[model samples]
Target: MRTPLPGVAAACGLAAMLLLGACTATGRQASDGAAVAPSPADEAAQQSTVDTKWGPLGPADRDLIVRVRQAALWEIPVGRQAQRRAARTTTRRNLGEIARRHAGSDALARQAAVKLNVPLPDQPTPEQQSWLSEITGKSGNDYDRTAIARMRTADGLLYASIGAVRGSTRNTLVRAFAEKCEPAVRARLKLLEGTGFVTGDTLPDPPQVASAPLPGNPKQPASPAPAATALLAGR
Candidate 1:
């Protein structure tokens, strides 16, 4: 039988009042005195987004910079290995170009990291190292298949991530890096796919967007800027 529930109801009401009071004390109340949660934009605005002179350096911006460095750390080795071990001439030539681009990308990543005061990992992530080890253990056709498949899959994922960062990043340096990286990464994916090893299994499921315009095909590559040359020399 509804055992005189008045006291219990009053106690529950008191607890609810205390919770609302705590929220209001923290300045989380609306004009009408009701507690309201902060919007995502408001929360982000409250945090320090502008951490560098280049502009707002968000977490995603820092991540892209680190990823470029890390990609070079492992991809450069695997690319060189594939250049030597791949069975197809196209694969070797493509991987060689990819390795060379990564060297320049790595230098740029380092320069960006220095400007942003972001520390980068010296080695590839464990998963990347594992992929390297697996490819290293194979040879001839097996090595070609393993390296191409792995690199294609990785490049597909990187391509999507680069697009996400490039579109949303507020930092100028990060945007520049993304602009350069997106094209290079897409070119690498195309190179890998052109080798004819990237079948349905190697391609990322739910295919990533590929709307970024291709860079101009220069007859002869331009020499590095003096500042860029100096940066590379310092490294």
Candidate 2:
């Protein structure tokens, strides 16, 4: 072939260089794109869920576990204080029983926390501590009334929570824990109510009923107040 022009030779050289550069870049990319294992932090993020033989542990289940423990934390002290200060013999006896039950509940809650790998609070919440402080400031009948009212209100709320968890929880351990708490809380409610201190205002409102009357009956007779409601109201 006739000798290539200088310009043509330079153009050819530039093309070859560009082609080589492109091939090298593509090879580098392919090598770098090979599968690599995730880092430890990434693995932890991906495995956020805790699996159990009973079922997957959910946030609600974790909450119930912690709350049960916290309840015992504050209530036990208040009950013990009531045992010392309640003027009525019956109230003292009830407080003693409540303290004993709470101790048992606390022990179970600790064991459950260990088994479930859920961390528990070492002490009561600030609000619970405030209630404890309030009870501690009073004595005799005053202490009894304050302790009963506070405990009843707190226990009533917790009782409802336990019932809800007991009914809905998928984890067998959590369900069992809630089942045990439900009746224990109910029994405590009855005990607190028996102290003649649980007022109507302190009790949680009953579940709402639909106001719409049935097709046949234009007016439904006013439902009788619940026995507990009536009893509390009279106090």
Top TM-score hit:
2
lDDT tens readout by residue for model 2, 1-235: 3343223333334233322321111111112333345567644433344688878776557667777898898888877877778888878989889988987788878888888897777777655777788888988778887788778767766775676666666789988998788888898989999988877654544544559665654476666567887778957
Give lDDT tens digits, candidate 1, residues 1-235: 2231112333233223322321111113344434457677655543335667778787567666776887898899988977888888988998888898888888888998898887777777655677788889988777888888777766665676677777777788888988988878888888888888877654434522448667756987867667767778957
Q: How close is candidate 1 to the true structure, as a TM-score?
A: 0.66
What C-alpha lDDT values do all the predictions have?
A: 0.70, 0.69
RMSD of each: 20.4, 26.4
Runs in model 2 deviating more than 4 A are 1-49, 207-235
Candidate 2: pairs in clash = none
